[model samples]
Target: MAKRDWNRRTCAKRGHTTYAPSEPELRERLHVATAAGEAWRCLRCGDFALGAPHGGGPAAEAPPVLRGKALRDLFVLRLLAVERGLRGVLGVLAAWAVWKFSNSQDALHQLFDQDLTVFKPVADHFHWDLEHASVVDTIRKTFDYKHSTLVYVAGGVLAYSLIEAVEGVGLWLGRRWAEYLAVVATAAFLPLEGYELHEHASAVKIATTVVNVLAVLWILLSKRLFGLRGGVEAFEAERHSASLLEVEQAARAVPAADQAAV
Candidate 1:
């Protein structure tokens, strides 16, 4: 099996971002004459692309194109963003359901009673109790809650949903603040998730708890949040070093004629 080339895959998908550096050494190293035409090395995937450069500037002004682990991290963050967005959507639906139920409690309860009778025959066939089943009993108990309490519950769910949506948008855009928010928010919920898992050891509960735990750790440690792993300064230094390495590697492959021109 071939290892994935995230840099090249991203370049291929998004198109290469060729750059002409104003620095004498970098300019010479990246500029090349090919059979097709004059070409410049892409700052992103390090591939030589034929054409006029997309942009030209000092080395420091070159666009910060993601590559290697940075590109991989972007993928991970986007995936997490999608997950968060989905959870937010589900939460909103749950809140709406709760709110609607609170408003039509009596009618819904009557309808549920009818539905119970409809399902009673099937339950008898399976030797199960229709109304006494844990899930059914839980639903029945919700009907006993006060309207104000249900409204409060719905508001809480809506608030949580909005928070998740905000996290999704920020994470999708790769904001540092969003990473911090996600780490903090998810960490804060771990105890609740753990409590739920302890109360009901279902596969869904266990999986949710595990994913949240991993996500919190992954973001906090990988992102160096709250001064972990040498803090944000070291985190930034690593990325800067990676960028410099890309330039150096591209410079290393300069043709003799190009090298001589410098």
Candidate 2:
């Protein structure tokens, strides 16, 4: 069975990137004289694309076109960005809820009391001790918080939401600073997440923790963050080498690659 080419597959969906190489040797490898004027090899999919090159420049100035593993890494980053955006939106909603609750705590408590009264008969039938229920006790504790305290809580949540939203946008745009920001921000709150899990274990919390851990680990290693795996230098070098143009450039050293292209 043949292995799949993710880069080519992605290019097929998104369209190919072609370049006109002004250098004689570079153009010889990339351009083929077709009856339809000319065909230049796609820098991404590596297929002969019949169209005017969108841009032309010296070989050294050719745009960096990502392929293979580099494209996969980009997909992962965008996916992670989506997750961050969802979490950010949720956080904002929660903050707004807390803010509203703080403003109308007394009215909300009255409504809660009425709801509880309505459910009294059902609770008795089920032999549920509503008065001493842990969940009810926890809910009641919210009423004891001062308005200022609630406002502060809401502010904190809103701030966290903003951070996540910014990180999401940055990662989606493939900004280098965003990668560092994501690592620092997510890792900073890990201790709190662990503590929350320790206080009350739940499948959702466990899953969230696992996802966050895996994200942090994957970003650090795959992106070579914090000097791991030769750091930014190695990461850049690897990305550069993945380009079809770079592959062809490397071929100049080995004559066999030219024949192989034929």
Candidate 3:
């Protein structure tokens, strides 16, 4: 029989008081222990404890809060959201520019009369439309000597497209710099989009404008984008749960090894 002193030492290490069980009580406890048992070792504290028969208190320390990776991932998501919103703004701008230019007889005429044969199918394709004829005629009469306007619009589009390209690539690389750049660029165009909707008042225009506005709000407020969701402690708790599962699996494997030994 194990000495009462040894039992007391074991119980003390486990943060419990020891009491000798009667024969019947010992059998009952042993049966319960075998059903729901856990074995643990605490080195510095010199403790070796087994789980209670049915359940137990906390087994490990609480995990630390999320810090580094949490912040970085939030930044990445924020940038990605900003990039999306910016691209949406750019799209609206491109569409508006096309709409305004088409309405201008001078612009349409200039574009229509250009050597579109160079672009093959594109020039010939839209030319067949009756509206295209009106556009061509309008441009010829309105902008007779202002070919410079066409040059300006083309240059502006090229520059804008280049900016979009840079933002998109940076976002793909998960850079926070790209996110800030995207917010600045897209915000700059909000007034333009608003003015366009006010002037045109079409369903299509209104929908496009609303979409960009909401996109901006979503990026700014989403927990994942803002880095306001789970903290470091949450991440550590998950890791700890995984560790417990691994330990339980290892314990089960032990009996299999003993059987193989026999």
Candidate 4:
């Protein structure tokens, strides 16, 4: 039997006799049957094999890799974790500031009460004046934090900071419980945020409130919290169905009848 030149182009455009493989010939040669209207091109010359005898062999194509919702979920989780981490840091700073002020209350009061003459030389060296009564008043008002109040405030801030840190870690690890915790913690503060806005509205306060609200809503809805929107099963199914492998398989199967007809 003569050896068939599989690499040669069989299309008229390539100055060769047009040839297309029959179903059995294609299956024997390429190990896969070609569908009707599916043109096979020569691997070497990039020409279509004419007629039903042959066309193009399957190109060396890799299946699409699917990340789908998994990728999206990871991105969202990381973003939330970063936000929580930042909040945790701020809480820690606030707690530290309170504790420091509480311990140095006496020293700060004495410093404020002392005459400007005591620090005149240092102030002059730094090209600054320390003769303002308002500055002393401000310091006095700021340091008016009672020892008991400072202790309580610092304790609360420390606790809050720990919670934020835990939440951040859990979120970064993509824990489902962390999503719930975040939603509850954020929602619990909404009322306080509203009250703050009512008392003294500022751009920062408004922006913070809006961001928290959006984050809470996004987690609740997107994560399908509390069985919303067909629940976990549906969500998982959607993710699985949207996978690249599943999609590609579905696409490949569409021409099954056509291939059979050939």
Query: What ordering of candidates by TM-score runs from best to worst?
Result: 2, 1, 4, 3
lDDT of 2 by residue, 22-113 (tens): 87888889988888888889998889888788788888898888789988888899999999999999999999999999999999999988
Per-residue error (Å), model 2, residue 200: 1.0
Question: What lDDT does each candidate get?
Answer: 0.87, 0.91, 0.51, 0.69
1 against 4, candidate with superior lDDT: 1
Answer with 3 or 4, whichever has the higher TM-score: 4
TM-score of 4: 0.60
Off by over 4 Å in 3: 1-138, 141-145, 223-262
Question: Which portions of model 2 miss their true places by more than 4 Å?
Answer: 253-262
Better of 3 and 4 by lDDT: 4
The total number of steric clashes, by the backbone 3 Å criterion, in model 2 comes to 0
Candidate with top TM-score is: 2
How well does each candidate superpose onto the true structure, as a TM-score?
0.88, 0.93, 0.38, 0.60
Please write out the lDDT profile of model 3 over residues 1-262, one tens digit for every residue.
7533432343345453211223342223222333346433322122334653223223232221122333344445546556564765675577566546545756555566565445556656767654346765664564554445645665677577667777777665555466566666777888998888778688887877677576556444432233434533554444344342234445656877999999
Model 1 TM-score is 0.88
